[model samples]
Structures are given as structure tokens and as C-alpha cells.
Target: MQPDDLVLLTGRDHQRVTVAAQEVGLLPGTRARVEGRVLDVTDTDAVVGLADDLSTRYGGADVVISNAVARLLPEESQAERADEFIDVSNTATHTILRAFGPVLRPGGRLLVVASSLGTLGHLDPRLHHLFDGASLDQVEYAVESWRGAIHHRTAQEAGWPVWLNVPSKVAQVAAVRAVAAERRAHDLAASTLIASVCPGMVDTATSRPWFSDYSQAQTPAQAAEAVLDLVFTEHVDPALYGELVRFGKALDWHDGTPPGEQDTMVTP
Candidate 1:
């Protein structure tokens, strides 16, 4: 980012994010101008308020990265709350893009932080019918169906994180594709690029509980590097504009088996 480029960071907790920004060299007038606000991505009103503040403060964002996620551990009482998972992983993701997509400048980039586990292959072929339509309604239906399928089971019985998270992310990836298609068809003048990414298992609050083996996990900075590569790199392929990427490689939905192997990465 340039010295003049402004950074607007929003989250539910502002103080921690502020300190973290400062730690990362994002200062008021040194490296870049930084602004932090407490905002919830799931609250439509809060999200719109933040967007309005952005317009009043600095017009709009050039890039929007949707990385909000929620994880339910196996031991948690309501770990089987698939509805909440859908809200965070699918609805909030589309909400972020929908709220900010129009204001994004021409050639701007919109990235949705999705999971590698989010693929049609992971779902039973019979369940694929949910994602066949182009409308957002279908997206919601797909999420609801997946959630309902596992709603009655406990986290341990339902495979904890994967069952709920994978399908929610699948809905999100489908949403991202729809968002990209909408941008291409309607916002022809702006020509924005929207893509999804799986930031390989990182040792963080949401991931650590489910993925206990963090010995080889990427640090927060290392994961950010993957996101930065997509944002600043000049050699990005146009084909990746509406696809899912991980470790700098684009992933194609496979047919043989669902992920979770030594050579394959399933979670984000």
C-alpha cells in the first residue's frame, strides 16, 4: 500500500485491531493512514453505517476482503447450531460483498475468504441440486438444506466443524460466483474482479480448537501474505476472477473423493 493510501479496518473489537494495526506498521501518518471502527459484519445496519462512514471519510474502499468466520467446537453446548454457522459463513460473506461491491472502483478486487472444504464434491451428488440455480434464493436454500441435514446431530456425531462449515462455505463460494457474474453483467463499466480464497489452516481462535495440530500451520502474517499476493500481484489470471484459490494455486472441484488426506487440505 502507498503512503497516501488509507486503511479502514472494522471489527467488533476496535482496540485490539488498533494495536494490531500499529504493530503491523500502519500508523496515522508514517506508513499509511489507518482508521478503525467497531462494526459487526452480520448486522446489516452496522455494515451500511460503516460503508456510509467510508463514503464520508474517504469515498469508498478499493478492495474489500470478506474474512469473517465463526467456528463451533465439538464440546460446546450448541455446537450443532448450523443456523448460526450459515449466518456467519454464508450470509455475512454475501452481505459484505453486496454492501461494498457497488462502491468498489473500476478494476477493483473483492475477495471472499472461503474454505477449501467448500466444494460440490464434498456434498453428496444428490444434494447438488440445491446449487444449480443462479439466484440468491437458491443459495439460501442450499445453506438451509445442508444445515437441516445436520441439525439433529451432535458436533461429534456430525463431524464437528466440517459438516456445517464445508456446506456454509460451499454456499459462500456459490455466492461469490454469483457476485462476480452480476458485476460482469451489470457493472460493465466498473469491471470489478471477485474471487474466493482458502487461507490454509492458521493457528487462530476460530481454527485452533477444531484443528489442534498447529505445528505446521501458517502464522497470521503468512496467511495475510497469501491474501496480499492476490491483491497486489500483477500477474493474476483473469480466469481466477471468479474461482477459489489456495497457497497461490487455483482449486478445481474434484469428483473422486472428499478432502482430508495427507496430501490434500480441506479446511481454510
Candidate 2:
């Protein structure tokens, strides 16, 4: 973030939010205005309220980033707590898209911070078309189908990945695609850019527990470089729109996951 930028940080915990604000000012020469709001991102009403507050107070946001997520992997049965992924993580992402998509200023960007395990190739091949929706509603239906499969205790049999995290993230990447198409249809694509990014296995306190081996993982600083590159670039290539970008290039939707990345279970 630049020194002139005003940043708003939100999370459920007050102390963590305050500390995050403090951390943003740690660098001596970096002096961006940082504010914190205690919020439950999973709540649609609260998220929209925040977006409205931004619009009324600051005219609108130049950039919107949705990074809220639930457990990367749980040792217990996915069937037991499948709602956490959908209701918490997936809902938070879609809510950001719904509320903020309309309020983003011209030339603004919307970036979804997802995971490298977010590709569709891990799921059964036949189900791929179900996720390639041009509209948000249709894309979301793919996630709902997985929810139905899990509720029926037939997710595996239905060709859905056993871990809820994978499908949830697939929905995230797919939503970016949906947003890109919507912008293009609305004639906003010429002014705005939208993309999803997979910061490959960053070794952060929050993420280390998700993997058994973290030796090869990049530090949080390493991961931020690629993300900031997109955020700081004055204009991105039109080809990057609605695509899942890794490093600096876009990945095909059918691309597989990184080796042993997600709970050490997702195949490479």
C-alpha cells in the first residue's frame, strides 16, 4: 500500500484487528492510514452495510479484496462440518462480489485471494461444465450441488472432492470468472480488471497447520509480491480477466493442485 492510501481492515477479533492495523505501520517510511472494523464477513447484511458505509463516506472503494476463509482442512469428517466452508468461506466471497461489485469505482479492481488448491481438475471431469458458469447464480449452483452431495453422504460417489475446501475454493475462482463476464457484458471491462490469485503455499502462522511439511513453503512476504504486483500495476492485460493467475500467468481451469499442498491429500 502507498503512503497516501487509506486501508480498512476487518475481522471478527478486535485485538487481532488492532494488531493488524499496527503491523501495517511497522515500516518506518510506510505511512498509510489504517482503520479497523470488527466484522463477521460471513454475515451478508454486515458486509453490505460496510460497503454502503464506504460508498456514503468515501464515495466508493478503488479496490476490493475478499480474503475471508474457514478451515483449510479438518481432521474430523467433512460431512460433520461442511457448512463451515460454504456458509463461512464461500458465502463471504460471494457476498463481497454482490455488495462490492456495484460500488467499485471506474478502473477499480476486485481481487479474490484464493488458494493454489482451487482448480477443478481434482473433481471428476464430467462435472467441470457445471462450474463453468458465466453468471454468479449458475456458478454458485455448482457449490450447492456439492452441498447436496455431502448432505446425501454421496459426495465421493458423485465425483465431488472429499475435502470441502477444494470445492469451496473452486467456487471462488469460478466467481471471478462470473464477475469478469458480467463486467464485460456491462461494458465495464474496458475500465476495470478482475482476477483471482493462488499464492502458492505461503508459510504463515494461519496456514502452516494446514500442511504437514512447510519446508518448501514461501514466507508471507514472498507471497505478497505477486499479489501486490497485480494491485499496483496501473493496468493489467485483458487476458488476465476472470482467470486464476499464479506467479504472473493465468492457469487453465483444469489445472491440478500443487503436490501434497492441501492437507497433504490433493494430488499434484
Candidate 3:
């Protein structure tokens, strides 16, 4: 948190967001102005409205970090919440990019705080096409197809595993790639970065419930160091712009497994 920076934190829970701001305010000698707003990121209109309001007030923002996510309980997978999952995980990125990307200031950063599982490798190769394309409609169709397949018990046939999170995570990274491609096609200021970051397995409510062996999970502050490194760097590597990064390095786009899953990384 920079002394000159005015941070805007949003979440669905008003009290939670307020408390977070107050906590930031308490950081020693920090003069950062933190404001909390009630935002349900899954809502398209509301997200765009916030972006418009911000544009009017701030002209544009220097950074936009997407930390929104939604996951059903492990028991709910068979019950099938694929559509809701995609809405929260996949389409939410589209909405974020559309609203925030344009107004990102020169040399600004746009980061999606995704999971390490959010890689093309997470999904079977047959399903890779869902995320490889840049078209927004492609993303929409893929989400529609997966939800339909899950509803019909054809997800496996459709090249998706019973666990829906892998695909959702992959799609989230793909959304970052799509926006990155768009960013590259146009002229922009130096050091402008657009990428999705995986904070690894953090010991948080969102992740704690999903892992059977939580021994390797990093604390929230620990996981945040890698992510904050990207945000604060003076010049981000160009190679990392469109990629899904873990621990300040880009992950192999086509690899079947991300390194974090293959072995635990030593905490720095």
C-alpha cells in the first residue's frame, strides 16, 4: 500500500470490505486512502456501473486487480453448479476486462488474482480450445456448453472432469490472455502489464475447504508477496504480460501440470 495511492476495495459484504479498509488504514505510517464498496462482481451491470463511476471521478485507475471467485462445495459438484461457476469464474473476467481495461492509465497494470490451477494444463487437451480463442463469444459459448454438458451428465464425454474448478480456473486465465492480446495489438505506454497471477494454495476459507492435505498451503500474507511483487515492479517483463504467472514466473501454457502442483515450492 503506497502512501500516495487511494485504494478501492470491493466485495459483496459491506462490513467485510469496511473492516478490510480499516485494517489497511491501521498499517503503520501508511497514508493510503482506502475505500470500500459493496460490489457483487458477478453482476455485469453493477460492475460496469462502478467502472463508469470511477472513470468520472478518477479519470482512470492505475491498477485493476480481479480477486473475485466462486466455488461450490465439494459435495455440490454432482449436484451441478457449472453455470454459476462459469458466471463467477469465467464470465466475470470478461466483464472486468471490458469495464476496466480501457480506462487503465498509461503504464498501468491489470491483474487477475487467479489460482495456480488456472492453467490450460488443468483441463484435458480436448477442452483447451475453450480458452485458446480471443473471442468473447467463444468464452460465452464454452461456458454455455459446459453447463449444458454437466446438466446432461455429458461433461466427461465433453472432455471435462467431474471436478469443475479446473476448467473454471483455466478459463479465468484465458480471459487474461484474451485481454492481453488486445492490449498488445494497440499502442500503450511502457511497463503496462496485463496478466493473471496464481497466488498458489493459500490457507483461506476459499481454499482450505477444497484441499484434503492443507499442510503445503501458504498463509494469505505469504501468498500475497509473489502477487504484490508483480504489482510493485518498476518494469514487468514483457513475456509475462499475457501469461499465467506463479511466483513471479510464467507457467507453461501447454504443460499438463503446473509446477506448483507437482512439488511444493519453498517459501521465500
Alpha-carbon TM-score of each model against the true structure? 0.82, 0.89, 0.89
Residue 61 in candidate 1, Cα distance off native in Å: 1.5
Worst-scoring 10-residue span by lDDT in model 3: 259-268
Model 2 global lDDT (CA atoms, 0 to 1): 0.76
Roughly what TM-score does model 3 have, to 2 decimal places? 0.89
- Model 2 poorest 10 in a row by lDDT: 259-268
What's the number of clashes in each of the models?
A: 0, 0, 0
Model 3, residue 223: C-alpha shift (Å): 1.0
Give the higher-lDDT candidate: 1 or 2: 2
Q: Write the per-residue lDDT of candidate 2 for residues 184-256, one digit (tens) a residue.
A: 6442444676889887877766566556787788987898788888877776677677788888888878887
**What C-alpha lDDT do the candidate models reach, one value each?**
0.69, 0.76, 0.76
Candidate 2 accuracy as TM-score: 0.89
lDDT tens string, model 3, 1-268? 5666789889989899999989978888878888899998889999999889878988988888898766456455432566777777777888998899888877788899876677677677778877786465677678778878888888777677766667776777777887787677342346788889988778777666556787888998998898889888987687788888999899887766533323321111
